[model samples]
Target: MKRPKTKSLVVYGTIAAILLMFWISWAGGIVPQVWQVNALLQDDPMLQEYPYKFRAVLLASGVATMTRPYDMEVAPFDFLQVIEPDLAGKAPNDPAMVAALKRLRAHERRAARVAVSHTAADGVEWVLDRAWYHKHGIKLPPKTLVY
Candidate 1:
């Protein structure tokens, strides 16, 4: 029987280590215990006011026609629906425009309000905007979605 070479052993060990690191990162993602809150929000830092922001305000601000209540605690996310677009390397409003439109229509009754935001960083410019809900044939509902 022939013995395995030292170089071959070293190469195989290095590859195994690399793959393990990747698996650790992927599998541990999303669990709060293994994830950071700031890490998630900071991932998208745009300036435009979010539609959910408006929706939450309406829901918690004493609902225009209801008597003031003391138990309303607004959730962290303002809207039940959020449409985030990633226009990273391709042209703006590419084939993904249709998907964007569909996202807009998903929770139509929630809020006819759409918010757009854009941020520029590291020599890259980003633009995000949502059309008016009513204009899109969608209406804003009272309670926002939280998940």
Candidate 2:
């Protein structure tokens, strides 16, 4: 059999490279968005307390994931609100929900302060503080969580 032409090989290689790049970009972008939404939803105290709402939010997230184009920019919370507006807003007029929200906010504030204080001086202290926060599930502020 005759060997393939150089032109054909170049065309095939270019197509393969394009496909690989697309796949890499799609996976890299979408996976983090999904994880971010999942984390935010799971860590929400109100969602945990309300099973139906949790299911609804998860379903909406899944739909958003499906409909979202590869590598498209999307704010996870914004997509969430498009599906269920209430999920993004303040809790309903329930005392327990309000208390839970307050507690979560307080925890977030404390974690932020601790992270700021430790990270201000040395890298070693920052690492140690991060490890402690993770071990304790302190849920450090979003910026601190990145390292």
Candidate 3:
């Protein structure tokens, strides 16, 4: 059989390289958030108080994995508004939920600050999408969960 032409091989190689870069950028952006969220879910006393409830909130909020595109600023607590009715009778001010929200917000912020310590850090996936915010003339960090 005849071997593939050099031109064809180069084209295929270039495509693969581009795909790899995109994959890296996407994963880099999401992995850190996932790591931070999971870590909080596992270790935060408030979150652990009602693991199932918190997990349900995370899933329902579409922030469970924290991997969705442009999901850097999403947190489990952000969905509190949408889910207030469902939880109004139960955990509106549940100590665990409130504490968890505060802790998670702080944790996310610190992670973002660390991940984007330098200007060049913007090239990768940023927690809180800090790079995107900066590009849009928003100099402040992401908003936090309100009690």
Candidate 4:
């Protein structure tokens, strides 16, 4: 049988090298994904109490996970209440949504501060999606349960 050419050998070597690198990274737990975040965001049971607080907790988690994205399985949400929508950019918040978010943030801050100072003092957080809010119509936040 004729031997393979050097060109074929080189191509095989390159493919093998790429595959080896991918395998090494996977074995070393170097790949980070959005699955865990989605799970935590979806399954954080305490989350049912405070809506929008989820956004803040997630923001905080993002900041915290800068070092070990792969090792980071799940983290809390943050910055929901403080979020300022950029209305003029590509992701511009609709005018009505921006106004609504600001109002919601204000409400969260007011309620949280009051509950923290007078009752728990820890200030619990909560997150509620727009769909859920409209469906169930929550009158209060997560902290209110503790109060």
Candidate 5:
């Protein structure tokens, strides 16, 4: 019987190690753990925001799951219906719900602006405002996605 080459053995072992690391990271993602902690341990912010940020996180997680189907499940806003049937029809029209959504979107846009500004200052100038592009003679790229 011929012996396996050491080089091939080393390559296979390295590949296996990489796969194991990926699997472990996927299995141990922090989002679910955060949910569990907030739900069970009564974290004040998570409790007070009940179903707003929680719902947002769920939708975000669901979208993330779409990108990594094997590792995630899309348990989005509809899950709120399952858990709190009272919120189904009423939430859409509720002033508080609308205000919460607006607040969340504002927070997201503010964070995006801050990130773009920092990146631009750090020489990722392509993402900077059109004013910066014109100042530097870099043609502004057509807008793609907003956030």
Candidate 6:
């Protein structure tokens, strides 16, 4: 009887340990990264006015691993719904928020262009440049010219 009880205890302990590790990894790593991204976005003058929207976007982007400027082209509204459901519906009607969103989009586009230019020979740059071309309706020039 004691042996059976010991075996059950060991199994329960193993399951508990797994759960604890998952919680720790998420809370210690991902949560802090999300907060750091939010702080950075909040500090930006262009984004300061739209604190909630910025937070929503940052959290979603962090989860999606959307760290690159080109990755930000994903619509903020989708994330806003998850982060701040109450404000998501009203965002379209708010002129200030709309303007801020536009500014953020433009900034991301410029950043993506700069990143592509700086890393011209890299694989990442190749992908980013393709995206940039598609977004701006520009044709990709010859590979020789790209490098």
The sequence of per-residue lDDT tens digits that candidate 1 reaches over residues 59-137 is 1111211111111342112122223425333333456644544443443322221211112111211111123343444
TM-score against native, each model? 0.20, 0.23, 0.29, 0.26, 0.28, 0.28
Report every candidate's CA lDDT. Answer: 0.32, 0.38, 0.44, 0.39, 0.38, 0.44
Please provide, for model 3 over 51-133, each residue's C-alpha lDDT reduced to its tens digit, 9 standing for 90 to 100: 22221112212233222113545444434333343443346377856865665456544433433333223322323433433
Candidate 2, residues 1-147: lDDT per residue as tens digits? 335687788889999999998998785533443344445545666545532222111122223221120012322233223334455564444464455445444543333332223212111110122333354344444542334
Deviation (Å) of 80 in candidate 3: 8.7
Residue 12 of model 1 has an lDDT of 96
Worst 10 residues of 1 by lDDT: 62-71
**RMSD of candidate 5 to the true fold?**
15.7
lDDT of 6 by residue, 31-103 (tens): 5544554455445665445323323122232131224222323444443343344545666658755764566
Instruction: Choose 5 or 6, whichever is better by TM-score.
Output: 6
Q: Give the clashing residue pairs of candidate 6, or none.
A: none
Error of 4 at 25 (Å): 48
Q: Any idea what lDDT model 1 has?
A: 0.32
Residue 127 of candidate 5: its Cα lDDT?
21
Quick one: ranking by TM-score, best first?
Answer: 3, 6, 5, 4, 2, 1
lDDT at residue 17 of model 3 (Cα atoms): 91
